[model samples]
Target: MNKKAIVTAGLAAALSIGAISTAQAASKEKCYGIAKAGQNDCANISGTHSCAGQSKTDNALDDWKAVKAGTCEEMGGYSKAQAKELLKKQKEMKG
Candidate 1:
């Protein structure tokens, strides 16, 4: 293939990947206190780890998983606001 054609193809591929990632992110919601161990969607709030599948405990309020919006509560997950409340309660109990 010509050099120009190859570069065009590469650019198209990159744009396609970016669009797919955006769509996936749009469809997901950050749900807290529901992910199982090693099943989180991304890093914890404390910066203890990066990437998915790294949660140390199930239902850790600081950790979150991606779930479809409007379905997290059904799945026993907390919204960001609710999660903050839960975290506060936990800290109170511990202190």
Candidate 2:
């Protein structure tokens, strides 16, 4: 193949791979309190950190990792709403 054709093919393959991964991510849900230390998928709910893999505690209420949709509760992880409510309750009790 010509150089131009090879480059075009490579670009198309990369884009398709990205699209596939995006679709897979769409099927995932953030499961709170499931991440081990430094295993979180993104920033924690408490904002103590602002990046993935920065969680300092295992299974923190504010930390989350992406798990397959519909399997969070089965895995003993809370939804965002549940985590938020629990955090609020914790704060209230502390006061």
lDDT of 2 by residue, 5-89 (tens): 9999999999999999999999999999999999999998888999999999899999999999999999999999999999999
Query: Candidate 2: where is the Cα deviation over 4 Å?
Result: none
The residue-by-residue lDDT of candidate 1 on 1-95, one tens digit each, is 99999999999999999999999889989998888999998887667888899988988887898888788889888888888888888889999
| lDDT (C-alpha) at residue 81 in model 2 | 96
| Model 1 spans with C-alpha error above 4 angstroms | 46-51
Query: What pairs collide in candidate 2?
Result: none
Candidate 2 positional error at 78, Å: 1.1
TM-scores for the candidates: 0.83, 0.88
How well does candidate 2 match the true structure in TM-score terms? 0.88
